[model samples]
Target: MKELMDFNFWEMILRTTLAFAALLILARILGKKQLSQLTFFHYITGITFGSIAAEMAGQTDVPFMDALIALVWWAMLTLMLSYISLKSSKFRVIIDDEPSIVIRNGVILDKSLKKARLHMDDVMMMLREQSIFSIQDVHYAVLETNGELSVMKKAAQQEPTKTDVNAPITEPIYMPSEIISDGKLVVKNMRELKLTEEWVMKKLKKKQINSIDEVFYAQIQTDGSLFVDKKSKE
Candidate 1:
């Protein structure tokens, strides 16, 4: 009872608060990666990080400065490895496993399943989750690094496209390219879309916008029309 009474509440509060702030800052620096996007290496690293932060926040006996140093060092190492992975494809492959062809030509590859550490049951379950009941229905199934099953159905099992229907071929559709964003002309996008400043201005003028700055957002639509949204009056 005496020892419990002697505990410094303020000090513990301060330590917990510091740990939370550090964790928040580190999370921001690491960038946002969804659960599906996280590879095996990242998942393990995340667990280790959470362990460190939890220890720092809950353990009053641990030195605050030492805990912070350990936390920051771990974050720095993660960042350094991420940089190396970005620069070197080999390093990236080392960190993240290559996608394995678990199923090819409607045949399940036992060797691939073993290498991916997946069982036949697991594969069947995954396939069923994707609405694929039979193994013969899949032409190709890739076990992605994140453990996702990317399936390519056999030609007979796949949906028909416009080309299959013998529909009249029209002009090829393109992605909507933003020529202007937030009242600023995007030169690189303009060049990519092979658009000139004069063309952009003429489109804006059609929308009753006299100047480029008057438009907040402008994009080239798939139909080759200029879509412009005027800036609201301040």
Candidate 2:
């Protein structure tokens, strides 16, 4: 029993306990953003802590002072990074994902939506919730980091902008672009435009689009039209 509770064993236990306490303290100080704001740096920090804590806790024969020193080092590094993000815009960008404009001129920016991992349906739903029944009403839309959509309506749609205008109105045309379907091109859509693969090839060639693999999304409208967005754009 005495041999089991030797200096090394006691030291290791003490170190483990102290390290755990320090980690708990730091977690509390960092607050809930550690979970809510899951940025690149936060992910890295979490993985580092988990790995080191596990290894250090298992080292039953290591000196308590050694574990304590390591814990302090990690804690200080994490706190420093957090402080840098709070104070520096450059650092904040590195850690957190930035808001991107996903809709421009009433048309969804396919590349931006792809980069943000959002679908057109999701964006449209957000728009509907914002009291926008048609995409034409939106001048700009941003996908915020919190997964919320911020929208700016067209001047003619908003209250103040419409108050001064008394122009005649036209029928609302749904300008939905049938760009892609099931991760493949809609051949029917091509036929509707009286277009062929030849025309698509021509447009692709103009944009230096050498292969269909380059395109992740494409849209077509009631008008003879097509829009291809490259996977590499993101």
Candidate 3:
């Protein structure tokens, strides 16, 4: 009985490994878009592949050949969709939705938002993440193919260009930081910086920062200096 059980365990492992390898190869053939910049159809293909892989992994009776066939079917379907989307604009529109102008000339287009099934709150959050406080600052805001917002600010609202300032060019700010960010660490940072928690607390005490939660971003520059940017806990 023990030998039989071990045989079953080994079979399961072998099948799982094969399924994983097959998925990886098929995914690579299907293209890198499977992992990034996914469209609506790409998302559906991912879900289908995941379901098929799970079934192949858990069901011992399912043949490895069957799994391979299913994977081939999905890959063919993905190729067909890609070909159609590339060859015809109408098919591309059907497969991957076109970019919608959510904001044009600093005016929020309610019709575009409704068509895109996005809300004002969602728009506001995206704007905030882009460091845009007011809609007036935006010249055009496009909802991209990957479901991300691409923002273009008005000329006046953008960072001061040389033409705007009518000044001579100077050296641009060069980033020289090895550690750009350290998020929420009480012990790890102490070890990394070669300082105790008590010393860190003392440094924070000078700036009236009582806790780590007050800091949203912390960076260590090449000069062995630390810069802290804190956000309100609220």
Q: Which candidate is the best by TM-score?
A: 3
- TM-score ranking from best to worst? 3, 1, 2
lDDT for 51 (candidate 2):
64
For all candidates in order, the CA lDDT equals 0.80, 0.69, 0.74
Off by over 4 Å in 3: 161-164, 167-234
Estimate the lDDT of model 1.
0.80
* Per-residue lDDT of model 1, residues 1-234, tens digit only: 766755677677887899999998987888766122478888888888888998898898888888889988998898889888866656778988667889877888999989888999999999999999998888778887888898877656666786768544343243456787768787866886788899888887887788998887888875689888889998
TM values, all candidates? 0.65, 0.45, 0.67
CA displacement after TM-score superposition, residue 117 of candidate 3 (Å): 1.4
- Candidate 3: 10-residue stretch with minimal lDDT: 172-181
Q: Is candidate 1 or candidate 2 better by lDDT?
A: 1
- Worst 10 contiguous positions by lDDT, candidate 2: 169-178
For lDDT, candidate 1 versus 3, the one ahead is 1
Residue clash pairs of candidate 2: 178-220, 179-218, 179-219
Better of 1 and 2 by TM-score: 1
**Model 3: number of clashes?**
0
| Clash pairs (backbone) in predicted model 3 | none
lDDT of 2 at 216: 72
